[model samples]
Target: MITKEDRERVAGWFAGRLPKQWQSAPAEITIDREEITVRLTIPDVDLPKDASDAARAEARVGRAKAFREETRKQRMEIAREAEHRYDAKVSWGLALGDHTELWTHIAAPVMTRLRQPQRMVLDTLVDAGVARSRADALAWCVRLVGQHEDDWLVELREAMASVADVRAKGPATR
Candidate 1:
């Protein structure tokens, strides 16, 4: 359970540690239990005002790829330092114009025991070809719920944080 202060501190650390020229804007840092993802927005490619949409799109992708390759060594060094300090794996991404790409992120497996009704839901997704297997179906379902209920989930997380704060303030059990 990461506190709000912990999140802010991590963000601040990245803001100061990252090279100024690397990001056109502040880095977007997302932290979970096992990973910390840092997404930086690179400056848009300078193209002619009358450039075609396809050309612009291609340039954006090229720019992001170049950035990734050029900074791979330096990024690895930074990620190693961050991972050591934070005790979590570090993932990197880039956002160029309207394009975003995440590379070298983890796909951690989760285990669960589902009841018959829950199993049926996943089976339905697999049977309908929405996913390749029950595991994929469960992931798909979670993603779908997240997309639709993001606001509610955020509120719930905030409430949980408040509960953690209250618990911390109470008398020590130990």
Candidate 2:
């Protein structure tokens, strides 16, 4: 686990070279598998209070592009140093534009085939206002079960591994 000191060190190194707008933005760092991913939230542009929506949108895109181009080298250097120090691949992302669009979690769309009963259950959830859509209702249901059955899930995984091991062994000799 990377310590707070390591996080601070990396953040400090970038604060100087990053665009002024990003200097005060929060830096979020996480490690997955063999990679250390760093994301720096971009601050909102300092636009006039009377600025039009179109102007605000344009400013955001322009700022994000400029900031990315300006800091590309610095970001690479930071990633290199972080990879060396942590002995893991390092990646970086800029939290640009609108907050929701910028920080959305990256997930691949999944295609699933459900039985009639399962489909009806999800539909029922939506109709009852349990969730906004079938996808959301399914996600909520997953979260509910995951929260309640964490221990059961863990034990099930362990048992499956044990079974796999037992099956790998050839029939025992008497």
Candidate 3:
């Protein structure tokens, strides 16, 4: 189980290890059981006041691609070290202006057992073309729930973390 301290330590490590020139601000680090994603907000592209939306978007994409190619070696080395230390794969991304791009992130498969009613729900989504398969339908459903209940989920997570802290302070089990 990952604790809040573990997450903070990983973020702090990346902040100190990353080159100062790579990002204008501290990297945004997100960690789960299988992967750690580090996103950096780089300096924005400067354009004329009358620049069109297409020009701005093109510039952002160009900048992101160039940055990815230029920093490939350094990023790989950092990822290798991080992966070893954290026992998880490392994915990287960059944010420029309003555009963000993530690459090489894990899509770990999940396993679950559902009754007929639950299975029907997934089947309905697939039949309606909302998802390509049961797996996709399940993923869509989870994303929908997350979007709708984000605040409640956050509160629940906080409560769970408090429980973990309390458990840690209790007597050791045999």
lDDT of each: 0.93, 0.69, 0.94
1-174: candidate 1 lDDT, tens digit per residue: 987777888899999999999988999999888999999998999999999999999999999999999999999999999999999999999998899999899988898999999999999999999999999999899999999999999999999889888888899996
Where does the lowest 10-residue lDDT sum fall in candidate 1? Answer: 2-11
Badly placed stretches (over 4 Å) of model 3 are none
Q: Report the C-alpha lDDT of model 2 over 3-91, residue by residue, as the tens digit.
A: 44544566665555445655446566655436666677777789899999899988877877777788778677866776676676766
In angstroms, how far off is 37's CA in candidate 1?
0.4
* TM-score of candidate 3 to 2 decimals: 0.93
TM-score (C-alpha, index-matched) for candidate 2: 0.46
C-alpha TM-score for every candidate:
0.93, 0.46, 0.93
Best by lDDT: 3
Worst 10-residue lDDT window, candidate 3: 157-166
Residue pairs that clash (backbone atoms under 3 angstroms), model 3: none
* Candidate 3 lDDT score relative to the true structure: 0.94
RMSD of 3: 1.4
